[model samples]
Every structure is written in C-alpha cells, then in structure tokens.
Target: EDKVVQSPLSLVVHEGDTVTLNCSYEVTNFRSLLWYKQEKKAPTFLFMLTSSGIEKKSGRLSSILDKKELFSILNITATQTGDSAIYLCAVVPSGSARQLTFGSGTQLTVLP
Candidate 1:
C-alpha cells in the first residue's frame, strides 16, 4: 500500500515567522508530488512537483520535491495570519489508474 507521512502534525507561529512543512512517501511507480492549502472551504492547489531538486514558488510559498529520497518540503516565508491553514500533501502514482494518496496534513496557525 502507498503511504505518505507529514511531520509536525500541528504548529503555532507568530506572524512574519517562517515555516517548513515536510512530506515523505513510500509508493510504487511515483509520478508527482502535490501540495494544497485548505481553509474553511475546499483545498486550493498550491504546486505540483515532478522533478527532483527543482523548487517551485509563488509569493511567500515555495515547495521542492526529492524523488530520490521519496520526500518533499513546503516552505512559507514571512508568514501572516492569512497563511494559517491546513497544508495537505498528496502523491500521485504512475500507472494506468492514477490516484492521489494523501497524508494527514499539517495544521499551521500563524498568530497575529
């Protein structure tokens, strides 16, 4: 069975602080790694990383994939209260039937 694990299930930080979220996985035929931010509503797609060592960034958020190590990391710099949310990590396995296997997620609270 495919498995994904995220560290620091919950974290609390002050506004302007920087945070790094982790995600590791063990699966057969890995395709890509994905990150999402979930607020009160549905999750919003953040990034999809397929290459190792290459980082993808947008605004204060950035993410990188390490296919060799079977892991990925999400970084948020100069965090704000608006960045407080549940960050989700999902992995897609390569095959005829591709599906997303998600981790428990990291709950980040940025205090004002």
Candidate 2:
C-alpha cells in the first residue's frame, strides 16, 4: 500500500528557533510529492518537489525534494508562533486529483 508518514508527531519550539519537519513515503507509480501547512482552515499549499537539489522557499519557510530517498523535509528559520501549524505530506499519484495519500502530519508549536 502506498502511504506517507511523518515523524516526531509534535515539536515544541521557542521563537527564533529553526525547525525541520520530515515526511517519508512508499508508493507505486508515484507522480509527485507535496507539502502543506494547516492552521484553523484547511492546509495551505507550501511546496511540491519533483527533483532534488532544487528547493522552494518563501521567507522563513523552505523545502527540498529527494526522490532518491522517497521523502522530503520542510525547514523554518527563526520560527514564530504564527508558524505553528500542522505540516502535511501528501503523494500526488500518477493521475491528477486522483486523491492524495496523506500523512497525519507533524504538529509544530512555537512558543513566544
């Protein structure tokens, strides 16, 4: 069965701390890997990595794709309380909107 899983179920960080969220997966005929950040509303898109070395970044958040290891990592620099959210990792299958295999996600709580 194809699936994605994240480790360190939860993390507590102080303001200004840098944190990393991990996502691992096993799949068949996989198409792409996507990451999302969830607060109160549904998760907002973060990154989609298809190739390695190429990292997508916006301000304090960044991510890298590693198709070799079948996983990806999200990094936040100088974390803020607002950065607290559930980080989700999903697998975009061979077909579009075919439904993604998602991991429960890693909850990040940044203390002020």
Candidate 3:
C-alpha cells in the first residue's frame, strides 16, 4: 500500500518566523506529489510536484520535490497568524482514478 509520512506533527510559531515542513512517501507507480493547506474548512492547493529538484513558490510559501529520496518539503517564510493551518501532502498514483493518498499532515499554529 502507498504511504506518506510528515515530520513534526505539530508546530508553534510567531509572526515573521520561518517554518519548514517535511513529507516522505512510498507509492507504486507514482505520478506526483501535491501539497495543500487546510484552514477551518476545505484544503487549498499549494503545489504539485512531478519532477525532482524543482521548487514551486508563491508569496511566502515554497515547496520542492526530491523524487530520488521520495520526499518533499514545504517552507513558509515570514509567517503570520493567518498562516496557521494543517499542511497536507498527498501522492497521486499513475492510472488511478484521481484519488489522493494523503499524509497525516502537520498542524502549524502561529501565535500573535
């Protein structure tokens, strides 16, 4: 079965701090890895990594994939309280029905 593991299950930080979240996975016939940020409701897409060593960034958020290591990392710089949320990592298998196998996720709390 495919599996994903995220490090530091939870974190506490203040505004303007930088945080790094890690995710590793093992899947058969892997297609890609996706990152999502879940707030109070639904999860919002962050990045989709298919190629190794390619970093995707937007504003204070950035993510990179290491296909060779079967892992990925999400970095949030100069964080704000609004950045607090559950960060999820999911894997897509080739020829699957677009179902995503997600990690337990990292809960980040940014204090004021």
Q: Model 3: how far is 45 from its true place, Å?
A: 0.7
Give lDDT tens digits, candidate 3, residues 1-112.
9999998899999999999999999998899999999999899999999999989999999999999989999999999999999999999999946899999999999999
Q: After superposition, how far is residue 48 of candidate 2 from its true place, in Å?
A: 1.1
Instruction: Tell how far residue 2 is off in model 2, in angstroms.
Output: 0.9
Best first by lDDT, ranked: 1, 3, 2
Off by over 4 Å in 3: none
Candidate 2 structure quality by residue, lDDT tens digits, 23-64: 999998788889999999799999888878799999999999
Instruction: Give the Å error, residue 105, model 2.
Output: 0.4
How far is each candidate from the true structure, as Cα RMSD in Å? 0.7, 1.2, 0.8
Please report, as a residue range, the 10-residue window in candidate 2 with the lowest summed lDDT. Answer: 91-100
Ordering by TM-score:
1, 3, 2
Stretches of candidate 2 exceeding 4 Å from the true structure? none
The residue-level lDDT of candidate 3 at 92 comes to 92
Model 1 scores a TM of 0.98
Model 2, C-alpha of 89: deviation from truth (Å) = 0.7
lDDT of each: 0.96, 0.91, 0.95
